[model samples]
Target: MDDIQPADIRLMRNEGSLRDFLRLQMTNGKARNAPAKPPPPPQPSDHTPGAWPTGSRPPRPIPQAPPGAWEAALHRLHTDTQTGTRCECPGCDPTTGSHPDAA
Candidate 1:
């Protein structure tokens, strides 16, 4: 018996022949039928105002008082509240541990 050689094969380049080959292949099945992949999970919206979603604590607000400037801060606290230079005003509490005279 004689075996067919590579030289005996010829490539059909005609559109009709190519289309017929594709149609036959489709009817039979794919050479390697791949499973349909699931869609990816939706990502979270990153528009949050703070770092609450990062599994860490959010940052604190900035303090109005500056370090080593107690006198200047007292002046600012006094002026911002429209009080005179004295820290003894009824509404100005320089050490109450709360926002001063914001009323």
Candidate 2:
């Protein structure tokens, strides 16, 4: 086993048989079946836009803020509280009133 044996090594260089060797290697190691492909990614707007989807109604538009009354009052109240002044209302915020289960 320790001796340099000529039979141990196949010293047949390229010898014009490279094409045959590659063809044999390729055909011998082929996958039996086609590989499983991954499922495609979800498309944007599976539900169409502009109008509502099937059987569902479009969402209602949010009510607009009244001209200049309540918003100004709330902002002033917030500013006054921040500056250490008392709330002028003397009661709870009526527009966005607190509730028992409110977060």
Candidate 3:
């Protein structure tokens, strides 16, 4: 296979043509020799383990409302406890059968 020549690799690939490359290389060479600026110091963080600022708790995640297994189980328990069509209101007894699990 023939190796692609630099001429063929120019403006076709958004490459700075040979002239732009030469200028960039010269500029890069000068910058490479210059001293690098010192890095900035790290800023202090408010993060503290087990401690929240102003007595506030860490933000809870947004409620997705996507029921997980526990939520499903709780819902099942709640639904199962509901006496459908039986009218399981308070002060009603299992024998009376107003509410299934009111007791």
Judging by lDDT against the true structure, name the best candidate. Answer: 3
Candidate 1 wrong stretches, greater than 4 Å: 1-28, 47-103
Native-to-model Cα distance after best TM-score fit, residue 96 in candidate 1, in Å: 61
TM-score: which candidate is best? 2
Model 2 alpha-carbon drift over 4 Å, by segment: 1-35, 38-52, 69-72, 75-83, 89-103
For residue 42, give model 2's deviation from the true position in Å: 14
Q: Write the per-residue lDDT of candidate 2 for residues 10-91, one digit (tens) a residue.
A: 3423366556655765675664354667998775666565766678877789998889877667645542333465345544
Extract clashing residue pairs from model 3. Answer: 88-98, 88-99
How do the predictions measure up, each by TM-score? 0.21, 0.29, 0.22
**Candidate 1, 1-103: lDDT as tens digits:** 1453444323433334656655776765663476667998775776465447767776889877667588556545653344334555455545553334454
Whole-model lDDT per candidate: 0.54, 0.54, 0.56
Tens digits of per-residue lDDT, candidate 3, 1-103, equal 1465776667535765767656777898899899999998764486565666656778889875664655444434433234344332444444323344444
Order candidates by TM-score, high to low: 2, 3, 1
Worst-scoring 10-residue span by lDDT in model 1? 7-16
Model 3 stretches astray by more than 4 angstroms: 1-16, 39-103
Steric clash pairs (candidate 2): none
